[model samples]
Target: MTVAIVGDIGGTHARFAVWRDNGLEQIEVLATADYSSPESALAAYCERAGLSLGAGSAVCLACAGPVSDGDFQFTNNHWRINRAAFCRALHIERLLLINDFAATALGVTLLEPNERLAVRAGHAQADRPVVVIGPGTGLGAANLLPKGAGEWQALPGEGGHVDLPIGSESEAELWLLLHRQFGAVQAEDVLSGAGLLALYAVVCQRNGQPAQHANAAQICAAALQGESLATNALEQFCVWLGRVAGNHALSLGARGGVYIVGGMVPKFADFFVRSGFAAAFADKGAMGDYLADVPVWLVTAPYPGLLGAGVALQQAG
Candidate 1:
């Protein structure tokens, strides 16, 4: 197709779209398991849309897991997308493989000013770096570095695997609990979707509650509906999310700000905004004051990856 093909490939699913006039169209959600490779899924999207992809088409994919060189192989899904191979299969002339976290970071430009609700109300320097840390199927982290006036570069990162911060007694106990499972517990060890389920299992085990083997959605729903164990786990999740965001901000010196993205937190946006996120983010030891001055924003755009993919394709030319 003459039009651009863009996709945000997550651990579990892939969101694909075509863009025009700074807006996303023909958005489709497809199961990564439904196809053996990214190209098959792309072909299905085109067939379903009744559109034809011309040879020498252009494409971009913001993928889950890490991105290096020109390929992006999904972590959870069994798909390895090489730039050259992918370009050939899809008949794409040019393709940009972007890390999902980097895609979220790219949203700093697309995000409206009003969407950036000030959680800290700090004196932000426009040119200062900004951070993006989101917890979904896994933890995604990145930053936005200013290039020039009205221009910024989204830098991919893997800070999610860093050591987890031990704070409260409950948190300490959880760390010990996780140590028995995974040899070394990282920040994402207890922050991602599976992490939430792990936390809930620990809580259930400790309290002698029946081990309810539920998915992330069920756990979230039960928590929202007033299940004690699920509710407490959700609360702990919020606190930890805040602490992680704070740690990222301090490490990056993100005086421009920090943003929260991904699909997991959107459901609990109200609680997250009014939750311990702000407190935990500002709860650093010696740098508490400094971190307090850093602003934080929750990315509210639904199709940020679509815009980001366009940005990457534009930059590639």
Candidate 2:
């Protein structure tokens, strides 16, 4: 089957795949960190699949951070991509590079209704803009706007860097703690995986406890294993995430819904539903009612960005 090459590149990995006609098929993943450059990693993927670029197949790459002039400059990863390099290297007819969050926004429409775990049962229709966001290495945000019937345009945003408005006095204290360590705090200071650990450290310090330095994975593991401190931090992180997501929803007027897409949150789906997240989301004073009626969904599909890349390729083609 004739297919196009596509990828959703993250800091650590690039999900590589090809879509046959209009359906997704032959999906693979390569570690972006495994190769020093995106070109080398992409070459490995093509080689393993025995795929040649002479078909002049259009290449679509969805990457974390910003995309400009068909080039992707990832903030967290060292890879700097130029479309010309890939087009020449792969002998492709065309190349398209897009923001990963934008890819997620596009992918949401492709998700099955059941694929979404709804946090609030409200009026969610397809016409209104749908917001997509998640926390991994860092936070990513995007929104899908209706262009025409059954057609949408994904817009990437640097929502993660927005200032975190304090929700309560305790949260204000948390902000102060974060500010001491990192000047000019962004929402990512508390909403990301690393941000969760930072929250834990702040909590530990306040309680006169030894701050347990841990990574995102380690903290999440401890939380799942009934570690009270870790669990508390994770719970706090979830609430903050929900609050920020609600803020995003308000800004986007995303009455259609908010879709959470990331590797981190899906694993903590149960914990999220049972945590203070829902309450925090609706805690906005006057905006509380507005957000209370807007539903939130978590994207559970794997390799969503690759799927999004495929969708982008189809549209660009």
Candidate 3:
């Protein structure tokens, strides 16, 4: 019974669990701000869970940034980690650190039939390249290509940092407002949790009113309750999400599917389903027919990164 410790580390929270019997057990979530470093946080989680790492056990962490030369720096947080130090500290024989979205892309394939909700039913062919994009504390994107040998490859990219796409006149105005504040408005500028608050603020300013919410959560909550200002912001968020998702699809030729996964979208599933997401996704002018036939899926599986870490370890073996 060889079990591994799995982690999905993000800017706002860190998720930890033990992978056993192809599923996660003893799952725990911690606020990233509560710890000084990822090591301390891992130590705390292990201590609280009364778990120990054996000599041959593997440690896999799906991080929120690029992993280069066995080192990773958090994209939205301040924690930096070297794989050697982390492995030494944990006394583990194997370690795998990968981009969080890469993990999500791999995990998307492992999802159960009911774990996903199909947003657009397109003609998806088996084993074609697929894209996964999600927005949470930050935006994440990845592509999954099947290797045709019962294995798959996850390609990680920081597509979220691309320039924001303004679709409408109102959106252009909103972009101008955001640009004035942030200098260069990347997709992450309006596609992340902090971006939600920025959108709400800009929308409020556009309507000649003061921002009524102080944080992203507050604004989302207000929007969920059908508050006018927050609802406007939420709609704007979904519209932009559709535009960006379509762009990613076209760029990658991801006819297999486009999966949306994150901590944010599932919170407002109803609004997302009813919003202008589908229309905007298929509104690529001349390429509308091509995109209209591309399926869009919303991943609902919990602990997708943990599942992906297990997949990585299995593949390595």
Candidate 4:
């Protein structure tokens, strides 16, 4: 049997698995920092799985940031992929590359009911577009369009870099602060892991309080413990996330639904469910009613990207 390999490479980790019998096996995760390049990491994975690469093997990689034909650079990491060189080194018959969020969007199509938790209740319109957005090392967004007969197309985009929207006077004030600090503030500037920490510090500065948390995890811990500043920052984070997601939904007319997939939101699922996200999502002045009927789901699947890369590989074949 021919061997197929799929990978989901992010800023921090690279997840690899073998595609066999239409499912993933021998799944392994390696820290990106542990290896100098993806080729090295994949070599380690193959060693652990007792496999060899040759002309009979095929590989698909879901990578962070925009993908192109020749060479690619990761948005949040130092790794670079020279497509032709990689294939030459691996001696693979075929290699496919796609944006990571595009893979996540494809993964949404393969989700089971239990893999997702509903954040809003509404009916999803069949055949309409679906929006996939998430926050991790960076913010990512994509759209999934159903093409009928069980086929779907995933559209990748840099939606995370769009201008941050302001909904209220307080948010406007915050925007000014952010602009002063970072010049031009994009959604990713305040919606990512590092952004969360920055938001916490800015919130403290805005309120004349001393910032206590140094990272996103610490801020989340403080919020769950009912620390005032931490709670406020987290709330703002969810609200901004909702605002950005709503913008994407509006841009794409995503009546099929919105799937939130990432490492950040799931960590505070309860708080997110109760936060200002819902109100902010549907807060568009006139389009509020339209957005209210659009359902939103938080993806809880552990390896959506890897699964999606396998799906992409199958689709290519």
Best candidate, lDDT: 4
lDDT tens digits, residue span 166-258, model 1: 779988887788888887988887789998898888878777898565877888888888889988788888888888888888888899888
How many Å off is the CA of 1 in candidate 3?
8.1
Which whole-number lDDT from 0 to 100 does residue 232 have in model 4? 94
Model 1: lDDT equals 0.81
Model 2: worst 10 consecutive residues (lDDT sum): 50-59
Please report the TM-score between candidate 2 and the true structure. 0.95
Models ranked on TM-score = 4, 3, 2, 1
| 155-209: candidate 2 lDDT, tens digit per residue | 9989989987788898888889999999998988887777888899998887778
Query: What lDDT does each candidate get?
Result: 0.81, 0.82, 0.88, 0.91
Please give the distance, in angstroms, between residue 228's alpha carbon in candidate 4 and its true position after superposition.
Answer: 0.8
- TM-score per prediction, in order, is 0.94, 0.95, 0.96, 0.97
lDDT for 213 in candidate 1 is 57
> Candidate 3: misplaced stretches above 4 Å?
53-56
Name the runs in model 2 displaced over 4 angstroms: 53-56
Rank list by lDDT: 4, 3, 2, 1
Better of 2 and 3 by lDDT: 3
Best by TM-score: 4
